[model samples]
Target: MDIESQNSPQFFSWDSLPEQLKSILPLRHSYLIKNFNVLSPFQTTENFEIPQFELDAFVDIDDKEKAREWFLSFESKSKTTMPESRRYEIKGKKVLFREKRHCIHSKLVKEKQGNRELKRPQSSRLRNTNCAATIHLRLELCNIELSHPLEVNLRFTHNHVVNSAESLSFRRVNGEIRGKFLELFKDGHSPASAMYDYEDALYLSATDEQELLVLLADRATDPDYDYIAKLFHKYREMALGDRNGTSMFKRLEEVVNDYNNSGHGKAILQEYDSRTGKAFILCVVTNLMNRVHERVLQSGELCYMDASASFEPLNTSITLLYTSCMVGALPLGLFITSDESEITLEKA
Candidate 1:
């Protein structure tokens, strides 16, 4: 019998799969498998169990190559010539770079008296194997249809649809993002002290645009909970130095700058600095307030009050704080002092 002919798709079925996969075939093949399992033994398996071989119920193609070939044969969908490899067939597949190299070998050691003895072991052969063992299967394309028609081709600055959709799908859970960064600047915590963990968290979470936005939004706001805000104020006040010396604004600027220069925060820093950003920071704070309140309500902590009423105070506070910074700073030409203008401490 010819080897090529022996390997043909015909005369091959689930029965022909490897033993490991063949064990799973009965469960897959039984039409009543779902209902059968529902009549529970009241037990759950910890590991996933897949049949050794399964017929391609959705697609007619058996082999990955055949699937690739079918996609390649399609007429040029565009004016441009299509490449030999088609995207749909190859999108998530990984081709082996080279044959496996033997790096580590397990050895059995037997100790007799003071000396040790090494032994080679024998292995059992697999029997009644099925096609599932030999053939690696792929996930069927998800046949998802949008409930609402997407007008993706529209010309708009920043493309609202794309941005909105991405924001919905990819936005980080607000509490998680806040808790992570707060872990760094935590009471008495500085980047210098927590540099190792800070670098790791920054690299891991901040790389994605949505995550970057989340962290930036988190740091760019004052704490929301009344208690937390009071605590933050207390800490800041305690850290503040005596009159004529230390400024919290300068210190905050340095800390925020440090956060921005590291990993993903750099992009956020650039975007915020390039644009009129106070409003964006306000919006982020609003997002946090709404998100946290929703979570609290879900957990039965607080009844959902009017979000608008809750947000107004924060908005006012943010504006007042920003205004204080702006109002206090003296322009170069407005005031000049070379230890010339001085105010004496009034002993009250």
Candidate 2:
């Protein structure tokens, strides 16, 4: 027979197929045949218990995007992916896809003595098996209308025995667990704290640490700090908004320069050295500080000036001029200097 004719479904029976071809059949098919007399014509009349192969019931989603999101969520839990060789097929409004994954086993066996051998063979690694398990997702239109919601069906098929403890799907956070995490996050708990609470609620051993944190961070309203930092470098204009389209430090410099040039009746003082002609002390009273001066004049006679190390860990001091206001003591002006010397303070 020609290659195509030999491979045709009608051309060969299961018993007549070559051992290599039969071995390549899906793992679940073997399990089905072993558990049920599905291939035997006479046993078709007999009633047999069929094993359940569904992990979750069909879910109805609003749109294709929502269906994809649901499938992704399921895939995340299962840690599996659709085979690259097979493309997802769409028929009418229905989409069908399958995910397959491999299984690995490790074991240690005692060494066996061999005849006339100097030493027995030590324990060796065993071959890994591509456990031909599969998860099928079918998304179909719920109604005759094309715009109707999609109904998603999830089915699991496995040929090998499953150890529930080792399964990713079993360890993954379910809807209930995710809902609790969201509630905690909305209540102002940090991702780390929320993950801790989730573990505590489930009495889980603290072995898996990062999964919950990653999931919560992905769903959080605030952009992750690392992502924001990356965006600040890559998309500086968007990250800074309307702040002169400059980086954070450059924007601070621009504010200082603008205040110095505006001339708002408040002093913009700078003292240069007589020898080097280099600026030694520079301080500016901004337009906002000028308004604060007016408020200080109206509020009280007593004013306070204090000098201390700057909040940031630097060799600089911040001098603050405060006045009593109706809302309590408020700073009228701020001066930052390289040193707390009397000469620098006088210039400020």
Candidate of highest TM-score: 2
Local accuracy by lDDT, each model: 0.27, 0.42
Best by lDDT: 2
lDDT of 2 by residue, 9-107 (tens): 122344554343233322211111111111211111234322223222223344556555655554443343333223455565443333222222211
Query: Candidate 2 — what's its lDDT?
Result: 0.42
Give per-residue CA lDDT, model 1, range 1-348, as digits (tens): 111222322222445543432333322121111010111111114332322112222223434464443322211110011111112334533421111111001011111122433232352321111111111223233311312111111001111111122222322223443565455555555434443454456557566877655443332221223424444455545665432223643554565566546532221111112143221121122233334434333323322211222242223211211111222421111111111112300100
- Candidate 2 residues lying further than 4 Å off, grouped into runs, are 1-63, 72-245, 249-305, 313-317, 322-332, 336-348
Per-candidate TM equals 0.15, 0.30
